[model samples]
Target: MDNSKLPINQIIARINDAAEMAREIISEANIFEAIIEGFNEAEGTNLKLTDITNLEAAQDWIDEFLEKYSDV
Candidate 1:
């Protein structure tokens, strides 16, 4: 597949366009809140993205859960 003469750049441009459209439709905070909702459901605990001090800490908190349940 890597050696194929496909228009990889064009394909990537299309993907970028879709991502840009999605960004216009939804804020990162909304995505983070959705992730927090999933985390709460999976862990059987209530959590809120707004409670996190910063994005970095929010990322770390998510990484911790992913690491703990990586096998699943």
Candidate 2:
């Protein structure tokens, strides 16, 4: 799939789907922490999961992260 060509909502949905899969295989907390780490690395900002208040905030982070790291 050419994810970079997808719309923002589709990218977010794919991220959510991957997170869900990770949750089923691992712990949700672990997956969330990993997400936070990826976000921090990709965005060059330190952000813990607790710093995100809602889905919108998380999506914003995901959007920026994808802008930089989608090819990964």
Candidate 3:
């Protein structure tokens, strides 16, 4: 089970897959950031989007916001 013995192509592919996952995470962060910005604008509240370092925190804010603001 030694990854160092893997072929160069396999190593490159694994790196590429990791990069793709990083990109996906950034995309999700951007989407959440936009929502946070809109919420701040509409509510006049300065909820720091950048302060949220991960998706879970973003989701927590979204959940709380919905609970407090959603009528449906």
Candidate 4:
């Protein structure tokens, strides 16, 4: 089947739509990273928040938790 049978304007519209969707997905990923980073930085500074019984494992735990919860 030849796509040329369709109007050029319609093909352009579909391409533009896909591009817009990609941009939106990228934007959402950025926002999610910002949220996770903000939480990590804020918690890192607070002695009480950062002070876990297992201090050696706390940072890893926090990072893993944030990464898990930060979803699209």
Best prediction by lDDT: 3
Task: Score each candidate by Cα lDDT.
Answer: 0.78, 0.81, 0.82, 0.67
Write down the worst ten-residue block by lDDT for model 1.
Answer: 1-10
Candidates ranked by lDDT: 3, 2, 1, 4
- Encode model 4's per-residue lDDT on 31-55: one tens digit a residue: 6556556666756743344245674
Please estimate how well model 3 matches the true structure, expressed as its whole-model Cα lDDT: 0.82
Task: Tell me how candidate 4 scores on lDDT.
Answer: 0.67
Pairs with backbone N, CA or C atoms under 3 Å apart (clashes), candidate 3: none
All candidates: TM-score: 0.49, 0.45, 0.70, 0.52
Q: Give me candidate 4's TM-score against the actual structure.
A: 0.52
Q: Cα lDDT of model 2 overall?
A: 0.81
| 1 versus 4: better lDDT goes to | 1
Clashes counted in candidate 2 amount to 0
Residue 40 displacement (Å), model 1: 0.6
Cα RMSD of all models vs. native, in order, equals 9.3, 14.4, 3.2, 10.6
* Residue 39 displacement (Å), model 4: 1.2
CA lDDT, candidate 3, residue 66: 76
- The deviation in Å at residue 34 for candidate 3 is 0.5
